[model samples]
Target: MGATINLLVMASMPIAKVLLLAAIGSFLGLDHVNILGEDARHHLNKVVFYVFNPALVTSTLAKTITFESFLTLWFMPVNIFITYLLGSILGWVLIKITKAPRHLKGLIIGACSAGNLGKLPLIIVPAMCREKGSPFGDVDVCQSYGLAYASLSMALGNFYMWLYTYNIIRIFSRDVIDDANHPEVGDESFGNNTEFLLKPTEYSLMTPNNKIPMSSKFQQLLSQFSGKINLKPLFSPSTIGVLVGFMIGLIPPLRKLLIGNDAPLHVIQDSAYMLGDATIPTITLILGANLLLGLKGSQIQFRIVIGIVATRYILLPLLGILIIRGAIRGGILKCDPLFQFILLLQYAVPPAMNISTMTELFGNGQSEYSVILLWTYGLAAVALTLWSTIFLWLVAS
Candidate 1:
């Protein structure tokens, strides 16, 4: 009971610290719009993506990972997959029941499945790890493990984004094409690209009939070939950073150069570690700013807010506890306190803020996403507080 109470107290500390810092920043107007400037935000994101994040991942994974540890961490993937699947299904069912537009269904599910990985794990997991007494038995290991998780989560998020975006585009485009090809369709103007081409447009318009001219076919082919190749994904700074870091971690010769007491690259690694340390606080502050700027009480629909909040905070956590308990009873997984806590932390996490950002990017239902985000966070804060208190009491008793 004492151990449980200690665990609960430790778990609550990080979340409280993050929220407090964010709230203070928001209240002080330090995080107000235009305070940091868009260019600064972009540059900071780039720095995090390309330098700090990868460095942190490489450093942590190299230090902590081995064949045995690798086997244990397998649970991370399973937990992520299950949560995503469950969230997606729930979102889809809700959309269907609401009879929302077909186009919105995908967006809704994607938003629900996407989580605030950056802030949640960085802030919450490390504390949880420390509480559970990781193999390293050092608080710093929490930060290191958090970084590794962050890298994996980021990679997964990017992959999901690409898949989801492609599906959305294909669905919408197929629908448009089908509408155009229907003989009974009275709207001749619906798919008329020639008319659109004749008129100057703000956005680039593409139509199925706009084939390349025969004379310019080779030139057009080359142009299309060049345009079709998006090297950005492959060669982007972030990709390069992650690749380099991953390689270094996997290769003992390179790994030796980056870490350890006698390492030549220790200084570089240390600097990166320091910078990586800043990521969590910055993310939390940004989240607070976003909430302060956009999430007004009046904008929320209480019933919808309650439903979404309950799904994340109540249903998910309870389900996760049950799953963990069942896994233990069945001997599917060894009963490790750390693993149990991790599963709990995953369930306790709030909705990903990135979802709302993505919804706005796709020009979908931003308002609904915003409401969902606001409620998710709000509910998570409350639920985590209550859960932590209860968990602490149970452990201490």
Candidate 2:
């Protein structure tokens, strides 16, 4: 009983921190205050994405990642990808059952697919580690390693979230706004030459062309796939930071120059660390600001909202436990409890904030996305605390 109470109390403190920051954000976003308004939050998000996040990921990865860490944590990226995959499958089912609108299909799928892997975990892990009853032992050591995990989570999360969710929303918008709902759009209207990628079957499906050779047609399909993915996301600053961090960590001479005591360029790491420190508060505030938009008056469907919450909070977390435990039983993961705890927490957090940005960019379901974020974040206080307790107790036991 005493231990249970201690763990619950430990869990509650971090919940309070997140809630308090979110409240402050909501207040700032009010029309009267207009301090952290939508435009303001959008710009703040850009700063977090382009500046603070990369700095944090680069610095943390440099300081904590080693060749051994890579080998031990190989399951993470795959695990995160699986989380997205499962959420997508769940979302598709929800959409079918709910009879959702065409424009909103991608939004539902994206919301369920991308957890708030980066921002929430970064704050939650360190705060949990810092608690008195913390199972991870040694505050400084726990925080150092925890931050590294969170940073890499953020980096990889950005990669998947942007590449997959962003495009999903964009494609759905084209379907609803231009293709079916609006009017048949000419392929020439698409400025980026991306329209052809969307309807790869329009040529073949609409008209069977026997004159096309199999190998030559296969080459055309390959080029279209390549064009759609584009190299831009792979070369995003955050992704680049991960690559650079890995290079610095893996190479001895580079590590000697920038990392550890007695290093020549140690000051550069300090600069990045200082900048990265600003990421959490700013993101949490932006999250709150965005949710405020949803709470006041939202136009989204009730079933859509409920579907997302169920998929993210209940289904994905359950799936996370099974996958991580199997990895453990299969000897795929190390016997580090803290590491296991981090992996489980990935499935339990709120939807990624970038989903909101993507909705706004595509001019489809932005308000609905905000509403989904509102409730998910509102419930995160309770849901995350419960999951954290279970995860902590499970690993500790």
- State which candidate has the highest lDDT: 2
Clashes of 2: 0
TM-scores for every predicted model: 0.71, 0.90
In model 1, residue pairs whose N, Cα or C atoms come closer than 3 Å (at least 3 residues apart or on different chains), thus clashing, are 1-395, 1-396, 2-395, 4-395, 5-395, 115-352, 116-352
Q: What's model 1's overall lDDT?
A: 0.57
Q: Residue 237 lDDT in model 1?
A: 42
Candidate 2, residue 357: the lDDT equals: 70
Which candidate's TM-score is highest?
2
